[model samples]
Structure formats: C-alpha cells, structure tokens
Target: MKINQYIRQAQYKKGFASIILIGVIVLVALGGYFTLKAKQKSSPEQTSTTATDQKVYTISDTNKSTTNQLIAESKIIESLKTNWQSIQALIPFRPGHPGTVAWLSPYSVQFIGKNNLLVGFEDGYNPGVAVLNFNNDQFKILETFKNQAVFTFSDWQSLINKYGNSSYPVSTYTVSLLRNKQIVSFQDLINVPENIFLKNY
Candidate 1:
C-alpha cells in the first residue's frame, strides 16, 4: 500500500512540470510577435517625418536666394542715380541760351543699361535722341526721326523697330523734348504695326 501511493505522487509532479514548460513557450512567442508588429508600424512614421523635414529645408533655401537677388538689384539702381548726376554736369549749353532753357528734357531721360542713358533734346532747330555713356563721359546722337510731323503712336513704334530694337516704345502723346519751352512736334510720321513690341516692357 505504501509503494502504490509514492508512485501516484511522482506521476502528478511530472504532469505539473510539463504544463509549466508549455506556458513559458507560449508567453515567449507572444512577446516576439508584439515586438515585430510595433517596429513595422513605426517605420512609416519615421519616413514621413524625414520627408517633411526635407521640404521645409528646400523652401528656406529658395527664399534666401530670392532675397539676395532683390538686394543686388537695389544696389544697382542706387549706383545708376549717382552716375546720372555726374553726366548732367557735363552737358554743354549754347553761347546765347538763357538759364531758363533746359539742355535736355528731364522727362525724356530713359535708362537703356546700367551706365547708358538716352536723353532727348529739342533746340528749335534740331530734335533728336542722344546716347550718353556714363563710364567714358561720352555723348553721341542716336537719331532725329522727323523734322516736324504728327508723330502718332504708330510712328513711335516704327522708330523703335528701325533703330532701338526696344521692347517698349514710348507713348505717342508723351513729350519727347522742348524747344524754347514749346513741345516738339513730329511731322509726316511713318506707320508701323504694334504687334512687334513685347508685352512686358
């Protein structure tokens, strides 16, 4: 009777040990599955964050480039103003002309380049455009379109097409220059098409 009881106790201990081992294996497998799932979910979020950071950096670089370009353009304009003042002092006046007579029309000043200015003058005899080189202190006549004709808008376009190759031609009614305080006239003006001029002057 005593031997039979010991055999039964040993069998019960063996069954309990098997149950504990199976439970430990199941827990370890579940832990590994949940850890893998977490890593997969976080990968996409990390990629999204990296892309957003790159876009922000690209925009910042573009803004900085535009700001630098604007600053450079401002400096160029200021330098042109200073050069204009020096050129104004060099214009020669006629011997008998009074101080009231302007050497060149202020309204007719046009900037062709950084150091080049196109000035118009009318002295009751000659009406023409003069090109001034600020760098070399030189001046030369560009052209005298008409003696005394009705210069319409079309005529101005023709002048630009023939000589200037300018994208923007001056308006018709705008005064070119003055002769003894009188507005210079354009007579027998030629006709030209307006389509040749560029849209953005």
Candidate 2:
C-alpha cells in the first residue's frame, strides 16, 4: 500500500514539473515577441512621410541616395577650389575647335576616382572634357573630348535624356541659374557623361 502511494506521488510530481517547464517556455516566447514589437515601433521610417520632413529628404525616396552623393560631391568641390589654378595648369593641350583657343578654363572639375579627375573645359567656342590622373602634385591628361554638341542642353528634359537622370555638377553661381530656370528642385548643371571616355574617339 505504501509503495503504491509513493508511486502516485512520484507521477504527480513529474506532471507538475512538466507544466512548470511549459509555462516558462510560453512566458519567454511572449516576452521576445513584445520586445520585437517595441523595437519596431521605436525605429524610424525608411521613407519620408512628407516633403516637409527635412531638406535632405524632401526629394523623392529614389533620389535620397542621389542627393546625398551630390552633397558630398559639393563638399569635395569646395575643398578643391583652393587648388583650381594649379589643377588648371596641368592641362597639357588647349582645345581649338573653330579657331584660336580664345579662353581655356576648367569650369566643372570633380574626382571620378581616388586619383582620376573629370574636368570640363569651357574654351569659348569649343567646350571639352578631359580626364586627368594626378599623383604627388603632378597631373597627366589621360584623354580629351572636344565636341561642343555633347555639352549643349536646350532645357531640363534634354539634359535628363543626355545624362540618364543623374545629379549634375553645380557651382555656387549656377545654383541660382538652376533656380531661375526652374529646371529642378535642386541646383544642377549638365555633367559630362563618364562613359564617353570608355569608347574610342
């Protein structure tokens, strides 16, 4: 009789322990679910709610990355402004399309890589593009494009079609030009398509 009583108590204890184990597992799962929900609620939205959100995020969601890239590029251009004269002097050849050189100026200069620069030359009648490689204060012209047609854009639509809708290079002065023309919400100028150099002249 005593043996039977002890067996029943052992069985009860085992069932009770199993119930406690199940309860603990269920509690842990609920805690984890609530924690995940809390984190999601606290997180910021990936897309802006409206245009009034912020200046940086005012553009379309697809343009956020483009805007960021342009901002960073603007900073680089500003820093390189101090060395404009030295950079311009590195151009070995003058572009002459119709007649005399007239004027040679590097209007839009931006770094395409760590040591490579894509320079846009405004030579009066013949605007051109030049890719220069610089190292240790020395600049070597890799290639040049002296086609006036490539740099001409009638309006914003023509500009987009030419440059694949990417953000264009802009200067402090040109910012107002873009605004006055109402070309785009942001200031920009037609940048030379980088792929032009990939092909043979």
Candidate 3:
C-alpha cells in the first residue's frame, strides 16, 4: 500500500511538472508574439507616404553628405548666375541676334535667338539647369559644363530638323549648355517632337 501511494505521488508530481513546462512554453510564445508586434509598431514607414514625407533630404555614404550636396548645389547656382550675368554683359561673344529675339539658330559662332530677350532667354530649366527665383526673373546656365561635357546648339538643331518638321528655314532651338566655365555641347534646347532637350517650357 505504501509503495502504491509513493508511486501515485510520483506520478502526480510528474504530471504537474509536465503541465508547468507546457504553461511556460505557451507563455513564452505569447510573450514573443507581443514583443514582435510592439517592435513593428515602433518602426517607421519608409515609403507609401506622400512625396513630401518620402522625399530624401540628403543621401551620402559618409557623414556630412548633406553639407556636401548643399555645397555642390550652391556652386552650380553661382555658376548659373555668373553665366547669366556674362550673357547680359557680352563677355567674349556679342549677342548674335540682339534687340530681336531669335528663339533658335544653327551657326557655330553662337547667336542669341530672336526670342531670347523676348522671353528674357528663359527657355526652360531642368535639374541640371536652374531658374533663379529671387527677382521673379528666369535664368539659365550649364551646371555640369566645367566637367568637359558639351551641349551644342547645332547638334540640337540637327536633331530637330531630323525628327521635327525638317524645315531648313525655321526657329532654332533656344538652348545652351554650360560646363567648366564655358558653354558646352552636352545639353542644349532643341525642338524634338518628343522634346528630349526642349521640354518644361
């Protein structure tokens, strides 16, 4: 009888221990699930938000990336201002078609379009080209010209002639590219049907 009682008590204790082990496992699982949910709730959304929210203010692999980007943009803007001022002052070349806006031309010597002053030479601006907003006046200059990149008006006109009306006697693409302190032939305004160079006007 004593042996049976001892056996019964041993079985009970084993059952109780098994129950406690299962309870501990279940509690740990539940706790882990809640912890994961809390972590997800604390995470920030990287996308699926408005542009203002999703816009990256700065991008850099190292520290001071924002500062470097701002400095780069500022330098480009200053170059643009200087070029605009030069065009107005006629530093090296005189305005080819002054007093009357040309709007387009194809001579290698460089000619201001009849529409330059008519539109104040503000053809249109892209990411590389910046239009100043200080005095509500539009201005343009090559942002990457100093890197030896070129934007030729003749090339632009050729494309326009090939893809566009192909008329020999028509308006010239009123565009210019600036690089390395001089006008470049990398990008200029051209009148393509798709407006590859001449867009945003």
TM-score of each: 0.27, 0.35, 0.25
Q: Select the stronger candidate by lDDT from 1 and 3.
A: 1
Over the stretch 1-201, how does candidate 2's per-residue lDDT look in tens digits? 999999999999999999999999999999999999865552122122122224544566888865675555455555455465665555555556567543454455644444555566565666666656556655666766656323332432333343323444322212111222333221232232232222220
lDDT of 3 at 52: 19
Q: Which scores better on lDDT, 1 or 2?
A: 2
Best by lDDT: 2
In model 1, the worst 10-residue window by lDDT is 187-196
Clashing pairs in 2: none
Local distance difference test scores for all models: 0.43, 0.50, 0.35
Candidate 1 has which clashing residue pairs, if any?
A: 148-187, 149-186, 149-187, 149-188, 150-186, 150-187
Give model 3 RMSD, 1 decimal: 21.7
Q: How accurate locally is residue 145 in candidate 3, as Cα lDDT from 0 to 100?
A: 18
Provide backbone clash counts, one per model: 6, 0, 23
Ten residues in sequence with the least summed lDDT for candidate 2: 170-179
* Model 1 segments more than 4 A misplaced: 1-97, 100-105, 111-141, 144-151, 166-201
